[model samples]
Target: MSIKSEPHAGNLCNLQDRVAVVTGSSRGIGFEIARVLASQGCNIVLNGVSNESAIEAAAETLRQDYGVDVLCCFGDVSDASVTADMAKAVFKKFKRLDVLVNNAGILDDGLLGMMTQDQINRTLDINVKGPINTMQAFSRLLARSPSGSIINISSIIGREGNRGQVVYGASKAAVIGATYSAAKELAAQNIRVNSIAPGYIKTDMISAVPEDTHQERLDSIAMKRIGQAEDVARTALFLASDLSLYVTGQVIGVDGGMLI
Candidate 1:
């Protein structure tokens, strides 16, 4: 199922003509990751819960800014049908997929006892099941590429165990489990699987935190600052490129050593 790399042969970071499917990529960390990958000449697929027009606009930006082919798959990744349909479109357009970034996730903060079943289900569906669905749908396409990479976005809360984020933490932890299992199972296909656990990234989600609590987070980080989306995006670039061909079944922390 392997296709030789003609466009980017022997290049360390060049992803020219390669296809990347990034879930929840309309904005924030997902979009930045897709954008960085696009800068390296990869044909980009942007998936998100945003409306069709918004997602299309994001796609258009990539096409215009990087002159790379961009596809917008507007739908929630939690829906299996969406990933299936996106896979079909991607295979039809590019015939293969080199990288799949599972970046779609939600943060519903609440004590486990106070959380509604719907909240719990929604978080798990998007954060955990979404990656499962995308991996299943795109595995074949990815296996066909000479270099296949799966970068799953996890969070520090998954390992650090934050209060009021029990379910969110559990779901992210589950993602790490999936990464380990997939890396082992898919190694035979030369597909490298890894996870990134970001801590207090300055995104729309982080902006929602209370000012005092946000400062408290800043104090906890050795770097004494919040992270930017670009930080995670660049880490993803390394994983997606030949630079990390030998890396798999590992969880990289992009937390600015916040946990330390």
Candidate 2:
């Protein structure tokens, strides 16, 4: 005898009419997260850098598929002026921001000794400083919401170090630190801050991993499989919505028990 599941009447998180900004959402995990948020009744602000056409197309897809209000703001999150402009654009159109997903990041892996200054700086700027800039620019708008949420996209490598990923790990580790501190500081204003530590996800980033190394990483997982973009997207949705109202300063892993 099989049990039947019932369909819910309303949206998952009461996020109807809310506004969310998802950085680097032109494609891949960030785009999936934005789509998930939009499906749950949240208006979305899709952000990307150096790809106006792609970003606009992503926004259009979300608008057409989910029928939710969609806006495109193209800029590098690491730039203060750009982030400020993004914030202004959001406020101008939506008047308030409910969710901020710091998903824009870069990964440049190499032996510490072989890594160049340019590689180090670029990685840190995009991965570490990018979130800092966005949070600073959008925190004011987030504070205005009754259930403001900030979701930082970190990685399991940040928690458990990986070879040749020292610089990348450091950047993500800093994100975790920022999430913890921001949660404490923003709690006074009814805002929640959390980080998602994804592990061995099957995205473009993972595709670039050497074949043998990828297999080794897969074997390390208890589930013995790579994760999907939707895995992280679902976690982001939880943090962005009121489902995680009391959850803050926590590093939730969507890593198929890899950390265990």
Root-mean-square deviation per candidate: 4.6, 3.6
What digit string (tens of lDDT, one per residue) describes model 1 on residues 114-158?
A: 989999999999999999999999998899999999999999988
List, residue by residue over 137-229, the lDDT tens digit for candidate 2: 999999999999999999998999888999999999999999999999999999999999999888787667888988788888998889999
Error of 1 at 6 (Å): 20
Q: What is the lDDT of residue 207 in candidate 1?
A: 72
**How many angstroms is residue 190 displaced in model 1 relative to the true structure, after the best TM-score fit?**
0.4
- Clash pairs, candidate 1, are none
lDDT of 1 at 165: 89
C-alpha lDDT of all candidate models, in order: 0.92, 0.92
Report the error of model 2 at residue 29, Å.
0.9
Q: How close is every model to the real structure, measured as TM-score?
A: 0.95, 0.95
State the local distance difference test value for candidate 2: 0.92
